[model samples]
Target: MAVGARLTPDVLELDPAAATDRIVAELRTIVGKTLRRRGAVLGISGGIDSSVTCALCARAFGPERVLGVLAPETDSETETLRLSHVVVSTFGVPYVVENITPILAAARCYERRDETVRELVPAFTSGWKLKVVLPDVVGNDLYRVLFLVVESPDGRQERHRLTAEQSLAIVAATNFKQRTRKMIEYYHADRLNYAVAGTPNRLEYDQGFFVKNGDGAADVKPIAHLYKTQVYRLAEYLGVPEEIRVRPPTTDTYSLPQSQEEFFFSLPYQKLDLCLYAHNHGLRAEAVADAVELSVADVERVFRDIEQKRRTTRSLHMSSRLVEPVAEIDLSDA
Candidate 1:
């Protein structure tokens, strides 16, 4: 789609300094006017999106008023926690750490997902974590089959074709992580009278990268409109630790190594951002292909995948529908 001008390299450009100031003001207004909350609370996962969102929250609500909760599970990277602490301390945001492994354990998330994984790979054992990935399309035909990748602590790996039933059961079980984190965040929010801040940037939010009512549940999503690239720029402008600014984005959900690109999108985030922007602006596949340096066919494939996921996840993005109002009573003295 034409942006009504020649599409330059600056099409997706972000001015970090100015973006920071503008988002800070927007956050302040949301908390002060919309939510009427005294503060913001969030789960800081050490990713650029969360780091920038937390920094903005602290700037808007003061370090003392913002609570940064570190929710890590057994598979969580140690560096995730370390970087999380760096941001919390760097901003002096009041912090809490919750090890979420037990919660998942109690909810039978591990056993259930493992049970499903073992159906495909009987060698699945206690020392391993599993990640499920969908096969990519080539040429005019895309593969719709799913694959389960298992890795052991000593770094052994195996790939298995996963049945749809297994994938469904596995996802249903593992989604407890995000939902559990949301429950913890809200427990504090209830007591502190703060708004739970969601940290999804435009790409993740628009593409349904979040679990419904889990990581997707939040009182305020301050960065949902910014693209992944823009979030990094804000990280740099806000002095987010250089390590964090440079950290590769990961889903960080699986026990084994997995990146957001591998888990969901067909392309890396840098390229995907250009494709998403082009797609949103009504550009043809060829136009996006030129911008992100991909073949026209690849751009078309990404566009189709984007539409498929957006359609698939529409249910996750909706509110409950009711035929009649529950709270609005018709009879005054019934």
Candidate 2:
């Protein structure tokens, strides 16, 4: 079998028209017919995944039936709400803006996160910004270590290796933001009698990049099966605003501007996409390295990291466990 030489950039390309039609049809069936919901509700994050998911939703259920929700917190990028508006308008879907700053504040989300940061850097204060990142997987480092990056009020910056306890504290505090936003999403969904739509792409989904009971909880997920790159292709075909279509992927969950690659994926979406596709299709490391323009060693490292994340984050994909299985009625069949 040919190794990586046979793989090309177009390896994941699909007929956008067909993909859109299929997704829209399935969304209708799942959200409407099966879920017993009249419409769909999803948070628009000003990211490609959410934008494309919103547009597909508009096509599946009439624009009027789909509700686009914008839930931005204190640390959210300034451009997030603006770009989210662009998405809702371009798709002609109605949306509600729920500024979650007050909610986060009430829950002490910022306070707790800052307290943890201060434990590491005593000078951390109001004007300081921070983000947590992992070591570059594509580099010589084989071990994955999380580092804290903080920008001082006066523009100085520092990186510090976090203890496991410190990392857990900071992450646990930051999780309030996602859980809060998810609460709002569900509130709207319940009031509207619509299903909550999740926007995670295949890579994020497969790697467990979502918060449990937060972004991870959704009534229907339309784009979970598509690669990040494929989501971009669908964005273009669906007429997602050029601004959102071109914006780089971001966590937007951090106070400091953080790209999704630096924060989680470790590799840019394009390369990660190729590596993931190769691994899934049984492509060898040498072939993947050549296809993605990375060294063979880097490809192997990425493949290992992929498996590692799968093992570590497997619970994110699972439902609540019980001592014994409970059989439920199939409403669709009923």
* Top-TM-score candidate index: 2
lDDT of 2 by residue, 243-313 (tens): 88889999898889999888889988999999999889888888777778899889999999999999989
Report the lDDT tens digits of candidate 1 across residue range 170-243. Answer: 88998999999999999999899999999999988999999998999997888898878778777888889998
What root-mean-square deviation over C-alphas does model 1 reach? Answer: 3.4
Per-candidate alpha-carbon RMSD to the true structure: 3.4, 1.7
Each candidate structure's TM-score, on Cα atoms with residue i matched to residue i, is 0.93, 0.96
Q: What is the lDDT of residue 141 in candidate 2?
A: 61
Error of 1 at 1 (Å): 7.5
Misplaced by over 4 Å in model 1 are 1-6, 137-140, 152-154, 326-334
Scored by CA lDDT, what does every candidate get? 0.84, 0.90
Q: After superposition, how far is residue 320 of candidate 1 from its true place, in Å?
A: 1.1
Error of 2 at 19 (Å): 0.3
